[model samples]
Target: MSEISNNFLYEAIDEDIASGKVKADEIHTRFPPEPNGYLHIGHCKAMIIDFGTARKYGGKCNLRMDDTNPAKEDTEYVDAIKEDIKWLGFDWEDRFYYGSDYFEKDYELAVGLIKKGLAYVCELTPEQFRTPEYAGNTTTPAVSPWRDRPIEESLDLFERMKNGEFPEGKYTLRAKIDLASGNFCMRDPVIYRIKYVEHHRQGTKWCIFPMYDFAHPIQDALEGITHSLCSLEYVIHRPLYNWVIENVDLDYKPCPPRQIEFARLNMTHTVMSKRYLRALVENGVVDGWDDPRMPTLCGLRRRGYTAASILDFIERIGVSTSNSLVDIRLLESCIREELNMKAARRICVQKPLKVVIDNYPEDKVEYFSVSNNPNDPEAGTREVPFTRELYIDAEDFAEVPPPKFFRMKPDGEVRLMGAYIVKCVSIEKNEDGSVKEIHCTADLEAGNGNPLDGRKIKGTIHWLSAKYAEDTTLVLYSHLFTLENVADIPEGKTYEDYMDPNSALRIEGAKIEPALANAEAGERFQFVRSGYFVKDTKNPNTFNRIVSLKDGFKA
Candidate 1:
């Protein structure tokens, strides 16, 4: 069970079951996606509702592929979609389905519609269908020349269309709805078309395919889906969805499916359209769908987002009818909250400055016990080696300290985190006027227990021994786009126009504590005073900073 309370969608399902509106054994749902592109963050919300709702009711949820359009579908996308759903911690088990598998049944249904005068073969070109003057308004429809064709002739032509007798777009099977109906979709929408192209799955089996509108409801009904949830865009198609089910004759089916629409997830600073995201990949705007900057599920997983964190985010956002943009900060906050309690702590310095303890013995080295997680005592501690020579963040030291600076400065004192307090006495400068090395004297008694006693430090900073620190690579990722609302761009300019040029920055050399030397890929850690980072699976030696520590000092 989820830690958060159930939202309205779940509440509705619970009520339906309690009132006997939905049978306990028939409350099945499905996540039907077209296998044409990778799943993005927007898809995550729908996935949660589809799978999560079913689990709550002890019902089954199917992961169905709406592969009606073969031109854009591919096995690559199918595999990626499966992998993404698994990563999100949802399983369809053996309930996987594909609309292409019902091609024959769909075609037969189209023929039946034609013979019953419910559908007809249309010869109208695409241009004539969309022309403003010829296209009718709410009260009228531009009649097709082929609407009055004889039923037997239409059925024979439809069979020939399926057998590859006609070229692509030369003929179509359209429903014979009210020509003067208020809803334009009721004005005889297209049911099937000739495409001559080979399908990825069915490959050359048939040239004609059923349209989404005509195929989806039947597919849902055949699979015993009780509720078909979709985005608000499908609300208008509800009438057509039911119309097809009512017109078609099914053999002993329990009940027809019901569809409910909700607003799609709209995220700030990100574009959800697959076409726009594809443009980013094809035009070199991003490396690929898995680029850490992208909103794709794979990208978020690679960038260190956890399944629990994503679910928590979805719950926090909740389900609503009104559309609004969710702030990216809310998503980051969920990650931070989850990591704060689980991710181990380590020390890493992006820009290193050498610090030498002058009074300490050159060959002497000791280990300090540091807590793995300060919030959880049972997590225990690990020993970190401390030597005479060490490395600290370059920004932690200043030759001439500012008014409020409390870190390492000449004649000033600061404590090395989990170690002894040290007073900086002098510094070595390079010919280029950059600080080469900082010299400090340690207060032994101030650390554990020694001769020199009772000293306090105003500031503390993290460090790594020069001999134990490992040189590693680091990658920093930022927002993909610079604009807050990518969909609201200027006319003529695309959402990609707002893509951030500096979304990813690669660092060749970074100093990390010995603890991270053996860290495996996909491991997450919070570098003390630095940020939360994750080991990159694609590049084992590389680590990506998910987000920096919140510094109240910075605006």
Candidate 2:
């Protein structure tokens, strides 16, 4: 766990330590995510920073569930978020917390604000409350009519709000910051909104919930977090994050936690919003959160991405200040680098074309030794069964060959991967004039490493013997969206308009090596000429395409 790059945030941390505003070995942080949906890759950057920063400074980081909004919160999301964080190698130990757990204390904090007259209950409708107005050539917030309500009346209403006597949105507690302030968040932002929905953790004890901007800072300081780390989108909310911590009566030891922002991950070809992601699932545009084409962590994991590879990606794309779009190819490149060294080599022919070794082996069967991984010596070799009938990829052969095409055609000579050189004799056609099968003769003198025939074989193709092959399903995946930055859609059209209709394709009756029959979940392999693949956890004898072999990223 090397320290994250020394950027503006870390520089600020340095100053905090040098000036003694922050003590030595006290740089605590937290990865506080709302329990709403599955964590996406963008969340990984936050995970790396919070956990990595704490480890760097000899401090601790807490894992907190910001389960304030009871309407959409669920224990399932909490569990999934924890699983994703743990999978990235962060352990919060005993510091797991939820913002709703502080409901009583938050109410008491509001009580203190009410006593100091720093906060008041408001009855403004959302339109009236958030309406923008111009005053003296400057943007001004429309002040709530209830802003000047008597202190006792506001306190009683807030108490009543807690007792579930008020309908949702009938009342809310607003921090009494300046309405004329330039920052919109400081314009008497609502900190507590009435929500009648049941909380995943808190149950029916409380009807009012804390806003994220209000609850997060309180949770951070309560946990004694030194640096409140978050994405750059919260830069505007940082002022409010500080405001809550400053005004709230707390027992924090050193000082209130400091909020720092860095650029959030934005990438091409995928949408990050939970609303849209859920739509994709509900609309059946995607299978679920774990669909190989999805950008969710579970989806990536199921798509054969390794935890180490994801961490490596975080390292490759260091933390920064300004938000920018990163090419998704970089992500694919990172996983490719990892699987290139770790994934074992195997042979599987999709869209199989029948090949018969006409002259040499009509009734004979032989085993040819193939290297498990040419890049890894310790991987050794495995015996590949060779029989009279075998299946190669249809794409590896050409009825009317393209320019300089070196693979099998009429009278064309090519190597049979790790086996022997083969020369195509003739082809058989179907009613549609498509080549249904190919006839070839294996050159017995051109066996593996013992080639007596001196003619050079330029192209080599992978194949599986029909006698020993296993029927498998091959899943091919493409980008989920057809356009980059799916967030910026054509005005009137929905996100489904840009979705790639053929993102996930299933091809049954694929030919794979018999050894793959015993492969367990998460076992990865390179399908010879094809891309890396992993066995699907939910479907037996099915493999999900992890990534294509195209290395799009520059070294």
Residue-level lDDT tens digits of model 1 in 1-555: 232255666666667678767776667889988998999988888998888777877888999999999988999999999999998789999999999989988988888898899999998878888875556776566678788999999998998998898888889999998777777877899999889778999999979989999999989888988888888888789899989989987742445677887778888888899988888888887878888888898888889989888888888887776678988878888888788888899889888999999999999989999999897788889999999999999999988778989998999988898898888998899999999999999987667433264445678889999988999899889888888888789899876577677778888778999889999988999988878999997986889988776623210
Q: Rate the local accuracy (lDDT) of all candidates.
A: 0.85, 0.85
Best by TM-score: 2
Worst 10 residues of 2 by lDDT: 133-142
Deviation (Å) of 190 in candidate 1: 1.3
lDDT of 2 by residue, 18-107 (tens): 998887588899988878889989888888898988888888889888888888889999999989988888899998888877888888
Q: Cα lDDT of model 1 overall?
A: 0.85
Q: Which residue window of length 10 is worst by lDDT in model 1?
A: 1-10
